[model samples]
Target: MTLLRGLVLLSLCLASGQSAGDQPAPAGSQNAPCPLLSVNDPVQRDRLLYHTCYLSQPTDLGDWRQITPAQLPAQLKWQASNGEQLAFPRSQLEYWIRLNLKNDGPTPGFWYLALDYAPVDYVSFTLHRANGSSVIETGDQRPFDARGIDYRYYLVPISLNAGEAATLYLRLSSQGALNLPLSLLTPDELVAQSNTLTLTHGLFYGALIIFALFNLLLFISSGTRYYFFNAFYMASLGLFLFAMGGFAYQHLWPGSPWLANTAVPLSMALCALAINLFGRSFLQVRRQSPLTSRLMTAQTGIACGLLVLALALPYNHAIAIITVAALALICSLFFIGVIRWRQGHSHAKWYVLSWSLMVLGTLTYALAAFGYIPDFLQQEMIMQSAIGGQVLLLNYAIVQRWRDMQKRLWLAENRAKMRLEREVAERTTQLQDAMRDLEAANQRLEALSTRDSLTGLHNRRYLDGRLTELIREAHRHLRPLALVVLDADHFKRINDHYGHAVGDLCLRHIADELKHAVHRPQDVVARFGGEEFALLLPDTDLAGAQRVTNQFLQRLASCPAGQREGLHIPLTLSAGVALLQADETQAQLFERADSALYRAKAGGRNQLVVAGNTPAPVGTATNRNRE
Candidate 1:
């Protein structure tokens, strides 16, 4: 690489008539004669025209035929170039560069003269050899096919016979910065360099397109305004870079020179507008400071106006205006990001960092264009690198914003759930109280339905129910059950002599005595009707039934039946008992007991009779039980 660089420097020194050991001529030398560039060695395939001479003209000079080499020496004064490239600020003047070539070898030379810059408006190449003169004109101002060689940059072929010399003149005109980095190469070197450049540009543009599509998908799914604006910004930045780098002119609108020229300024304006919108939304500028928000709005409006004027104004004027507007937009976005970050906006720190990178790159490129700074790096490469970094940072900021939102939503849901639980607990307590009160009322109704109101004992209905249940138990478990039916003896006579009220009192007195005799919890005592009573006993045999009736008769004989208002009324009861037999139904058992009671009443006033047995005197039953 060092040897190659030395060779390049030697060739440049030879073009200015200086050897490797000699000092370079001064920059003010305009009258020195230009040296003949010798293509003598076939091994030396590449050369750079670093020390070319140039003549400036204010307007179009009629034709190339009017400026032959013989007349040009007296008609114009050519100035020597100071560096490898010829750089000038944007201008309307035309520049003419001169190179004198000679093939001093035995073989003829076939070489390509090329210009690396693409945005020059018009370039005309004129070659005058010993054989004939040729002229070729092509630039972004002309259709792409108008070029003699089909390539992105300006390239033309030149040939010189052995021992023959040629004079070549190039005319350049543009409405943008004029940078001429001219080179002469063999066919092999041209092809190699073109391939290298194509690969580099492909990777750069591919990265920009990927970022653009990725942000577009995010915007569609999330419906975030900032994401939409970010996608638009990336797309416009890519398009502007494409046009500025000549890719759009070569590939997109090669047939239309006007479109090629207009795309640069228009795309740049769109980029400015999109960035302003993205920054405003990402930072929530309106919520933070209304004044800053309005300023961004105005900047967007200016960018939109520039978009319309880019086609209407001259290319130089439109590009200049758009460049200034874009710089202002970037700076303002950076300023707003700083303000928001200081105010505690969560996403604004990333915004500030990203815009800071963009602002640095854009400022450097702009300063180079306006001739205020050296072009240390290629403007396109610097901007592309900065934009890639900014895109990644901003995407991260959006992700952080989404996470914050999700957290807030989760917190709100938890609070609502806690409130609902409190309400549910209160409702549950109220329902428990209501259920407790309902249970108490149901217990009272149950007591009224099953108990006799007058005797405070099981009524006839309860007796019937118990009788059926006890009969089922006796059949299933082989247990004895007894039922007794009894009637109040001489009850009608008491009512006739002492009044009905006294008779009721005597019946109650008889019921009290019967209740006291049957003290077992398994026994059920009930009033059968007026002046009649029944007893249901579970697990009781015939002998047990006889004993219970005898005891009740003995107790009643010792006590007065009824006493009211100092009047006494006598009462006696005749009872019959039946034991539950095998396979006995409730109706059959009740019929047998009623039959025994009827017999007891027929035999005498008061006696106990057992079903399937003869009647026994109440006194005899009591005495037999005692013995």
Candidate 2:
């Protein structure tokens, strides 16, 4: 089925090309780019002919699982490949490498296949024998311990029988740069190259560690957020390099195949986030350039979002996001440097120099990743050098910033000394003015604290304190005091219908009604909460409070909805009246009144219920007209 699908796909590609009238291969296509690499004839101890194999990649992102060896012949005729490390434009395509190898040597031994572009996520190599059979497997995708040899990339052994002529088919897929720099090496040669690569990696890792530690200590000593961000950025960069260069797979996380797969994009995403923060803080982007500052903030958010996507999405999707974000971040940094440079930031010159190198190396590496160029340019090395320069330049920038701050502080001190006498006289006047203002503000605050701003009635705090004093006087004199608790019925309807402005006006209208209903100067009215109001009538009996409540309700009904736009929308409220009992505490009296209030609401609104009393006469309590 796989072979059949491959054949169908190949046929479809050719038919579409013809249908579109795509130009055909130029006249008598020249000889194959390079003869199939002969394994039997060793080219040199460490050097050999770089065979340019035939190549084909899926045109779509759909499954290429149907590709099989039976379709190998179809791809063999497609085209010849050229270059030590071929690059392709950014694509989510799967590629096939076709080559022929003859063991022209005397004996057969193990041959190691290596891929220099270590970040390529998955690779497959199949050795076809004279029989219809073949040996097929994959690289990089497999666990490090599972590889034929314990090396990064695809280190598989190809056991070619003496005098055997075998065809090799390799499949490559990745979310990162798509570079295919294939090398067939004897065991000794492979080890030698791996060791040389390891040494170079050690130097890079060592420098990263030093930078991270130095910045961390600098942050600790100076208490600056900038150094911490710088340290984190360097650490993330180290991890990214390790993941990309395959060192993380070999050493740090060999057991975590998931981490090995996700580490590059994750670390790079984090590195972008940290580096952006470091740049913002180092240059004071917010204070220096407000518009650019917002752009920087947005890019940082994007990098952070990509970090999550990297861990969750497939490598192909994650890589595409990381690549775009990476490009945007680099551009954003370059823009910041340019803005600061225009503003005459002294350290911005070195900052620009640093970012220029970094940008060049990043673009070159990214271009190769997308298959726009060959991989021989040592992009990884160039990026490493550029980043190192940036760290140094940023350190210098930090020092310069410190110096500038110190100079400003010194100038401020000198100005202070020159203004000492005048400042002392001014300070005396300010102190006298401050004392007068403080006294006036205290008086205003006292009024504000005691009164409700909305209704000009007593607030809850003032109500509680004043109620305590009134209760003490009532108990001491052996006199009666009545508590009237009024709750607006269906007040939410009023607010919902008329809006809160009129709702508040209606409340103030009720407050004024309570004040006008009072016959004695000692009657205190206060807004309880929301649309509820409370009244304390000292030296009053239940009958006297009952009469006052009737008067208050009548006044309330007369001014409905506070005459909004000259229209009176009426609202009703229920009330409970409780006359203080002998030795009753303030809380006990409040509870009795509250219970009566609920009973009034339960019976019907616009009515008053008296604790220890049946109710006001039916017509008197329940006869208020509803709006």
Candidate 3:
């Protein structure tokens, strides 16, 4: 088991391309003095001082320390070969030595001074130290450009005993200025470059906050899980980037170096979690092909393994593994997005493009970190370009998603409108059909109420309507209007002598005679009831009405019904005629006509009577000679 574990550790170290050792020097050389001075320049030669410098002041004397400086010669002379050193007793403080070089050459040339320290064992190198401090150191080492050349530096702070001795090497050469050219930088340029990284980190965090708030609002409004996942993933990615770049340690909690050291593993874990969640949301990885899902799972597992390795290894090894794993994870995400795009998910196309750009930027930075690219191309400018491109691509993808959602919503709204219109049209058509049917039913009811079924003549309701109209016309046009009321004499005796069917035939015959008597189109004849009928005439005087009524009675008396059981029966009618008064309604006109009818019946069964002009009922004896 031990051997297997060793092999696994070795494999991880090899995979990450990191050295496993933590101690800077070899074994059995624990007390050897640190060499701080070296000379490689020929243009200038001087003896430079080597000492443990203290930068603490009297602001707070409890955490302060002091140290003395020592000098060495330009060359390794016999007397100056024994190097000098100085140290301070305090443990947690930041200090640096000011190495003074005397120029031996006549012309001013470049000289190099280097300060070296062991790997950091504590959280931070504070200019002042306190017990409850929050300062921490991130294991991010990079070359700094002072003016025109690069200067390699370390920020790790350490303390030595009161009499500890260390050697310093001084090198003076014309090429030294080409390597460390702090004197060449303008003050503005120095400040700008110094805080460029810090500003970039701040902008990244600000973007993360904006994206998180935006997605949080979306989640609240739409209740979609995708927005939730995007918020979490974006926030995690921002934190991981901040931690990996060591900006979190530099400005946030500079006192806790142990916390800074843990950033690598913690960032890796968050990165893994972010990828896992993003895959599920953006790619729908679980529902994709089984092989593809397995591949995604494997990638997620690799990210998890990287975090575990970071925790188990030293700081340097952890950082190396995290960087390599981040690259691998980015590559995997890019390819997965490409695959989804090919499978007809158009949404994945934007994701693929975004990831491709990110992968290119990551590879560029990786090449720069591994010394495969030039320092100038790998510095602040390139870093900004890469990160800026990624942010722009992500913004474009978000905009594209928004546009697609809007289009879908518009289409759904249009479809609903068309569906509602169709439903309304159908309902309107049904209502129109129902209205037509109701009109037809009302006409049938009117016909049944106003027409006689036996003779097909207008019934009593028809007489009532026409009489009122005739009376109105008489008043309006100053013309005479007359109404005649008639009855079939002995209609009940006819129904008893012959069957009621024959009696109905006799009434029908009397109705035909009354219609024939009325020759003017303005006259109307109707069956008022059983054996009774009415005639209305407009523009007809009382004499004309009396003539028409007497003719109707004679015609009815002469009408013969052919043999019923070899017997013939004669039909006769009694009628009464009246002129409409100026102010008379149809009801009053009918009453006057009916009173004349009663007088006609009293004189004899077959006779005609004229209202208002008749002294007594005139018998039909006058019209009987003409028939």
Candidate 4:
């Protein structure tokens, strides 16, 4: 590198007609004939002009000297060549590039010199005329308004009459590669080129703004975190590009030299932060792979550390750190995306593609800054183009992921609805089965409450309730109703001679006989009390009730109670009948029937008696029906 730099300086000296070991040339040497960089080509007005100029730098720290207006006229020494380009390694020493220009022509009107490279930190351009010298100084290290020309790049207005001559000198020093490309432009060329550059940068920044707004809309509409991170990354990249290109120094932070100096490195650090955040979220690293996710997190932490260092370190040091962090971010994101793609992440393809473009662009930008790449419009616009492509690819990935998520959500909702329907159907079936069991159990309970346990006849409570309902119904329908109270004759004797079981058997037999005799579906036979049973006959009369009693007696005599061992358990019964009267209360009717029962028992057993009539046969019982 040292040899190459020596050779470059040697060529610069040879082109300037000065020997390497010669004494320093005096600056005020109008008598000496030096080459004049004349802008005679109207078509190539934007081209570099051959001129008399000198380039110098301080030998060491002890040789420090202020590059002011007083010292500049005498300080300029070696002249420049028209065909030679000034290219040098990065250095801290201030370089003074002096130009002795004379427009000794017939076609010139207004001429200007423009410095192409935008990254020079401190630059001062001076136009030395015969009257006196006037200086205009501007760079990233000074206020943007301090420039002789109000433009983005370094521009100095040179007024030279058609046959007049003037000396122009420029001082430059930076922590950047010293690649000076000058254009001696006429009025037309200056206006046209300046407008072109402005329009290009305007459109570039416009596209970047559009991308940011698009991502913002996406984030708002879909509520996805990745879109937000991607938007932030685009914004940071835009700022970094703007600052690095010196537009920030000219337009954005004109009054803040410190801010202008730090903007590029700070924005670069911020870009790293955006990339890490965007990569981790876009790839879903946390959910895809824990190990890779942890790695990404570490890289993200490193990027944050770079930002902190950016605040503390100088521009040159911080920019280096930020550049390395940007590289690390690219590698980490690419690796994570590849891993996720292999592990079945569908969006990883687009993520990887986007990062690849950005990586290429970043590499190109870094190389161009180090003078490794030839400076051209394409080289200057490389990062812009690549970043635009990245924005498109990343947006597509976001849309794809959103669509996939929508599909999954729709499927989940449908499945949940179907599952709910199935559960409802199952629950309904279970309820139906339970209802059937409950109905059967309720029927058994009804029987237990109203039936006689020994004979399965309606019990006393049922007899009372049913008889009342029957009486009311019969009354409403203007029909007949009757009740017969029956008792097992010689029931006590049977119990004493045989056993209580035999007496029970006798009662059951009489109950069955009475039940069978009734025949009417609406009629009911219920056990009134011990040895007594009541038969309720709905829509029946006195004659019908009597026939039922006769039939019951025959049934009892035919089928004795039951055959016990080798003997027959015989059972005989007497009954009392009561016909309902609309005017008579239940007690009056029951009392008359009970009185008739007493008369029948008093006469003889195995006979029936009609209430308020002759005592043919009767039985003792309280009429449970109380209608």
Candidate 5:
């Protein structure tokens, strides 16, 4: 099928070539002198080629024979140029150009006829002089080593003696656009032109190489697929540009004309693939808009198909397919950029701008090729400049994307940190509250352990601890401290007669009486155990201690237990009081008070006795007086 198509396409080209060949010259232009080109010692810089050349195409499609220069005046019909490059559609048609030159100076004329367009398959120059005629032929179809001058374009050397007039014949044939833009240049002008073209190409290709390497480095360092895709795009695009400008043929694969003819289509196909990959990755279309992603993927398949066809098919057919695919690819990518931009992709705007310039440049060159517009700038130059701008702009876009990604990552980390801090702060507050509650519970437990359950007074444990503290304080300050120990006069009898419940009531009454008698903040009153009680007084001497003990006994005698409840149960307390002496321990003082309480019980049970035999009166119900 592919071969059949190639054959049909070749037939069409030949048909078109034949039709163009039959086009008539402008009226009365036949027999007119070939436009005369006057050359001086130095060629005029501003004399355009269109002003001096006449073009002619053979009318015989079947006549494959070459014309001789001697036969030219009668056999060929020349048409004046329209003052611009003569453009025709893609064809393998032959075009003949005639130029009449006159050297108008004493010095010989040395000129170079330059064909700036690069893809011409074959070009032949025949110089007809008065003495003889010579021909030089060279083009991309020939090896680069075969050229007389080592240059990318076809340059044919022309010379004339002073005042000599001659006619030159040029024959060109190509399978692509036959846009003949011919120029005559002296050696100096050609050098200057070469310099200008070199600088322009250097800057354009340099920017592309730089962008490719920069993105490739980014991909290597970061492992980002987007950077890799961008690098691939730039590299492929650069290759396409090089092949399009004929640099690949001139410098890269000069001996392989097959490779040279296939290079443009192959590079273009690769560029298409790269564009799809880069567009999809850059726009994040897969994640953001799946449909758009699928469209780009389909375009990628088309590019792959183009690649296969470029290798398998002939150059003209492959190039025709590549051209249509490239147009569709560029327009589709531009629309994808617009779609992604609308969907809020960050780099989409840059994508759109880059493709917009590319589309403009492409259309400009295409229009000039089809004769819709004048070729103001060389089509290659316009396209190269546009692509250069696109590369730089997209590089900026990639950098911007990197910065934006960094900013987003930083913001996410900061937000996570703030959330963690808030959690920590809340947990800290909760822990502090829990600690306070625990402390309070511990204090309650301590209180429970140290209080008398029945009497609600400090128990013997508390009395012992307080006595030790007060004794130490007294020794340190040389202040007197007092200890009193007392017991219910007949606690056992009360428990036996009225039951243990009433006995508990009586003990509570006695505790109340003791509390009333000792009204100092520094006094410690406690149930000493069983029915015994003790009082700890700080800063109280022997006399003061005796007085407090006596008063407590009297109060106990007056307020008998069960009186409020109408039960006649009498209650009294017998106590022993001891003052803290110099160098006395709490154990010794407690033993002395306990011995004094035993004496009081022995002396008839209702009296107060002090330690060291200091005795108080018995407060019996009969006498109720002190002894």
Candidate 6:
């Protein structure tokens, strides 16, 4: 690289002919004789003379003169190698030139002459009118050229007339100097070249900056690492383009030569890294699918190779690095499509088409840059086609990616809504089941409140309520109503002797005996208290009640007291009977029956007591008897 730079510097120094301090003169030089003529006629003659003098430098060194129309007849005797004598009519001549020049060296500078003519004469010179307007002649000489020799040449402004001939001399002073040709340009062409370069570069850079900003905004809005990578990639591509020796940087930042050089490799490296990272994220290459992983590895290798090449070569290698990177990017896009296809990503088709168009554009640019096409074709046609197509493809890719993201977001939202609804439905079902269980438990609690738990019989609350209706019915019909209260004797003793299990059995036996002894449907048997029971008879007299109580007593006496492994013990029950009295409340009747039960207990155990024809007092003992 240092050798190349030194060689370039040597070439520049040799061509410039100085140590950069001297200004070289412009390339051409010319000499010619003066003429006498009306300035107006000479202007027309000189205009034609300059038209041919612009072609080349010739070898003859003298015999160049400008003449007026009056001298045209005498000058017509001159003949040369072509065997053609100069001829002029007296009225046709205005101005003319006889010229000779040495073509031994390079083309010479511009020369001019003012000439007059009379009558008729015609003179011609060879010079090309490169650019600018031709005007009528005046007395003063203007710049022109007599053309010949190997190097390039041009004609400056010169004038001639109709009645005279002008003689101009052309000289050659240097070799290999080319003229700054402007033969093809018009006024509008000159203006366009001067102005459009800046405007074109401005628009290019402006578009690049806008695209970079758009990617940056996407990165910030989405918080996706891929978007960030794309942003960096685009920015680096913009910087790389600016760093290249293009009209954009030439017109916009011409003074920043150091920045220009640094941007080359730096942007190359950054772009390579950005593209590598973007590929990894965009293709989900780390998911360990074999083909995707292999493709990613290959892309990484290519990117690394590009970086190494950029670092090792001269800075101008930025162009090669960018080209290689573009190729790698194209390949990566293809592999991404493959991965997406394998993974069942529906949007890959659009992405693939978009990148394919971009790759085509990039390949076109690459071909043009390498001089595979004409300069006019590359600059005016291929470049525009490539850039325009690539931009459209990039926009298409952006829209496709946006639509894919929107679809993913919509699916995620739908899934979340479904999950929430499912949870709500499940909770509602659970609440309904819980309410049903609670209602069942409430019904069980109500049943337990009125019934006896131990023997499954009506409790004291039932007995008390039924006894009142029995007494009222008996009083209305003047019939008999009777009550019997019974107790299991020696129940606590049974519990102490054989455990509470046998004591519970003893109570159950006594309850069974009492239920069996009550034969009437109107009679209700109930557990009155811990070891006590009651029987109410709605249509029975006191005698009938006494007889039923005695029967219950006998049945209890016959029941087994306890059973332990099939061994039996004797168990007995005691009872008291009462007849319903007129004007007596049910509580009074129950008190009398309770008193009779105690009397039976007092007269020895396992016996029945009947209420006698005595006033039923609260604490009086009734008649007692053993059954």
Q: On residues 1-627, what C-alpha lDDT tens digit does candidate 2 reach at each position?
A: 332343343234322423211221112223455456677557631233245454545455355556666654443454454433455433345666666777777787668766676766567667777875554454456677765556666665677777887777777766444666667888888889779877877787898899899989999998999889989988988888778777789888777767887887788799889889988888888876788789889988888898899889987567656766675686668777877888877777676777776666666565555444454337667777777777777677777777877887999998998799689879867865775679887566655576787888888888888889988887777676789999998989889988998888888877777777775657788887888889988777767788878877877776676565785888778999997776777898899999999999999889999987342322232233211
Where is model 3 more than 4 Å wrong at Cα? 1-189, 195-204, 288-290, 370-381, 405-627
- Per-residue lDDT of model 6, residues 1-627, tens digit only: 332343343334323333221221211123322222222333433333233222121213232234222333432332221211111111111223334321121332222331211101112333322232232321101111112111111222343222333334222211111111112222343346537655765676677667767777887987877767766766776666554323323444444444434455566666667667765676566774667777667866776776666656644344444555655566567667756856776556655665565555545444333222222223433444454455455556656767787999999999999999999889867865775689886566645455676776678888878877777776676666778888877778878988887777777766766678766567798997989888887666666667777766676666675454585868777788887776778887888888888998998979988866455422123422212
lDDT of 4 by residue, 521-589 (tens): 687888979998888877667777888787787778777766654558767777788887765555665
List the candidates ranked by TM-score, beginning with the highest.
5, 1, 4, 2, 3, 6
Q: Which ten-residue region of model 4 has the weakest summed lDDT?
A: 616-625
Q: Candidate 1 residues 68-170, lDDT tens each? A: 4454546566776644446655655677788888888798878898787678888889898877889887888899888867677788898888889988888
TM-score of each: 0.60, 0.57, 0.42, 0.59, 0.62, 0.38
lDDT of each residue in 290-359, candidate 3, tens digit only: 7878877787677677767766876555655666567666766777777887987667778777766666
What's every prediction's RMSD, in angstroms?
A: 26.0, 24.0, 26.7, 24.2, 24.5, 31.9
In model 1, how large is the Cα lDDT of residue 408? Answer: 72
Better of 4 and 6 by lDDT: 4
Give the lDDT of residue 334 in candidate 5.
Answer: 84
lDDT of each: 0.74, 0.71, 0.54, 0.71, 0.74, 0.52
In candidate 1, clashing pairs total 0
Full-model lDDT, candidate 6: 0.52
Count backbone overlaps in model 2: 5
* Top model number, TM-score: 5
Clashes of each: 0, 5, 22, 9, 1, 67
